[model samples]
Target: MSSEEEGCFVNILSRNISNIVDALLHGPENAFDEARKEGLLEREDLDRITNKESNGDKIRACLDIIEGKGNEKRICEKCGQEAAKRCVTCGILCCDQHLKRHQQEGHNLMDPGVKIEKLRCTVHGDLFKFYCMDDWSLICPKCKDGQHKEHEVVPMGTAPNKLKVVLAEKHCRVLKSIESNESQLHEVQEEEGQTQNAGRGAEDLLEKRRKELCQIVNETVDLMKGQINKRKMEKLSLLGKQKEKLEQQNESLHQEKSSLQTALQEELDTASFLQGSKDLLKRLETMSDFKSVERTPLPVLDFSKEEKNLDGLITLNKNFLEKIEKGPVEHPEKVELDQNNLRRLYGRSPSLDPNSAHRQIKISGDLRTATLTRTGNQYPEHPDRFDVHPQVVSCDCFSSGRHYWEVDVRSSRWWKIGICLNSMGRKGGKSGLGANPESWCLSKLNNEFSAYHNKQRTSLSVPGDHERFGFFLDCEAGELTCFGDSRVLHVFRGNFMDPVKPAIGVWDYYCDSVHFVHLVKQTFITN
Candidate 1:
């Protein structure tokens, strides 16, 4: 063969090497031996191919050896052995071992030459030029026109690049999802920090209020001590003057008695003794006739009421502190109001009933202020009077409709302001404000505030001190709300079965007085 034909033959074998190796591994076992005898495969190459455990490994070994040898040879179609002669009639190659079989089949033979061809489609004998995406297979033009007509076919060169583009798009989507997750995590962390900051702000406000209340209490204590000391000194000075007058009268009496005794002991005549006795006896009689010094009662101070007040104050303070330490209550409801609107629409000024006042509770001339007094007023004994508790009720009563009122409570350290049924007990302890089912009240004992109803006391969250308190009663709605300086302190809900009257209680002497604020009519212009 010419050099050009030899080169063409080598190229065809290289392209069909996989098919050739596959056929050799499945066919005659002497193919490798034949290649080695032709000096195309070394002894080591034969050993490697023989040592492979699987047909696939042996095929790969044989292809490698064939690729390196570049031998110009043909494989017999019948038994996969190296071809030495060609069958002229069939245009197929045959080895010497298969030569007699072919001749007996009446086929003529010639020495083998370059007769290998390129791989072609088995069905149509056409070269493969396209890739079928549907079945991931290579197809020739004839195959594409036949069974692969409906498949997505593309040229062999662009199939891999299209798949790469799809993968890149999916990778971009994955990265976006990861970014979204990170953003959500950051939002959650920021919310947690904001919640912490809100808690800290509340804590700071509570601490500031606590300090203010403490200072108020300390100042009140100092004032009370000063007043008590002043009263004590005045009482002591009066008693001291009376004591000095009594001592002087006793000394004068002793001197007169000694003068009479000396006159009798000298053994003088009866005339002389009588003479001395006359003056001494006259002086003694004058002294005895002198009016006896009026005995002054000792100064006495009673603190039983104050002690009780302190006990109650201490209990209230303890409850308030415990509630504060536990943190703020959840869903705290605060009712906001326009002070002027409430005052103009529903404000009332109920006068205190002098007939219902306790003996120790003094009522001002205007009957709007109630004061705790040391001495009982000489009020006529009346059935409506509170015989046990130091409490008083308003003369005005309400059975329905809304009413609002304000009280000046700054003067009192311990006081109660509320409403009670007109028919409630007035002669026993149960008649006290908020002590029985007939009454409800908001009380302040020192720095602590609380709401009481039906003998149940609820600690309130109103911090510091408030000088004025407001009350709103909606009898038809069965609601009573208390406010400290316009801020809602507590609310009481109940069934108002009877007429209720405004009431006040002051049991401590230090609690000077509480006044009811009366609002007058006024007009205003709004823009």
Candidate 2:
């Protein structure tokens, strides 16, 4: 075909492109394949059309490709004559002689040289003059009278202004979220640096202790040094994981903000802009529900008290070297509660307080188990609720007498079982199990166990497989002791000035429920 003739054919295709796209979209699933087999579409064009998410968008893209390839000779579909006019309603090419007959039948007609913009509703075949706010769609007058009758409809011209306000607000929120993520990332990096410095300091202290004990007990010094190094590595590992998580969150926020900015800068029509903005805004809202990372001082190793005890032992026993020649000597025995003592100390099982639970914590129907969830719960705002950590406290508090409790932690690998002052902070970084001065906890993080109090950690030597843990608190003696299956793990000594409640925390989503064991006399058994 000649270039002039091809131009005329292209104009005819472009004039009724919307109708052609609509027919192809609703025709069949193999329409693109058929077009490709007929040599009207190329392989790359088919691939491009397939990339579109919606059927309408795919057909429109295909029509664009076909229109660009409009160099073949064409004839009027009605008669064996050169096509000169196009029907807008039926999307058929017809010569001027046959066009007059179609015009008499009330079909819209357009010249080959006239280019038509697709502004008509596909369903109603009327020009879209209204925008439906409820559905975020464009509608015609007939559509407004039918399905969109109760919708918030406005003139198409005014819809862009309303959408601009919404997009602006969403843009501001995304910016703020990006800023918040950046701030958290900074805090995590700082914590990481502090942790490294603290680790070096602890190593130095360990070196000094090694020298002091090298002369009297070389084997014990090596063991202590190994424990210190292991603890340091664990601390650094935990901080590294936290830093990585914060970095990923910040990266996601940046991408979301970039997409929003691109949409704002594009010269899209009102309908396209509204649809794109609606999707972006929904995603922005979801991504904006970010939780702040809890900032706590990294725990450091303090073997000063242990060093003093070892020094005292060395001074008191001159035959310690002879005893070391035999197998490993036994240290002072830890208090192991028998079945009778356990039964005597066992009090009523304490239930978790829903109001004190974090939004990601789900309290069970029995009120004794607290489980971590991937999504936040629709919890009502309460002053005692923990906002930063996935932690919760018991409903009852102990003040005057001795109290005993057991937690079934068989299902979780990372958990904290402890007691905190009833007046402890509940909304900040220090609200965690043992982050503040008002709490004491024995935590099992991965394979390591440690006792935490006032942000200081004392590494405990305990078996990792112990599933049930017992806590015995003597308020009068100002002592809180944690016991594994057979032996006491660690103890925290402090003046009990206020009532304390049992608390539990779960850090990871993979962790299961931390249950408060209900003590029954019939099945009472203790290790």
- On TM-score, the candidate that comes out on top is 2
Which residue ranges in model 1 land beyond 4 Å of their true spot? 1-336, 522-527
- TM-score per candidate: 0.36, 0.43
Over the full model, what C-alpha lDDT does candidate 1 score relative to the true structure?
A: 0.62
lDDT of 1 by residue, 1-527 (tens): 43333333434445566566766677625654554554544578668777898887887676565434435556665665677765544556677887887667744344565322222366775545565656556567888989999998875445444433433443344344335434443443444344333323323333344444454433333333343444444444544555556556545644544564464345642222322344444454455343445442332433332333332332334444443334222211432365675675467888999999998898999999999988889999999999998889998777655677888888888899999988788997788898899899988886788899988999998877888888888766788888886777888998753578889998675448988888652211000
lDDT of 2: 0.69
Q: Candidate 1: lDDT of 312?
A: 32
Q: Write candidate 2's Cα lDDT for 138-157 as tens digits.
A: 78899999999998998766
Clash list (residue pairs), candidate 2: none
The alpha-carbon lDDT assigned to residue 271 of candidate 2 equals 53
Clashes of each: 0, 0
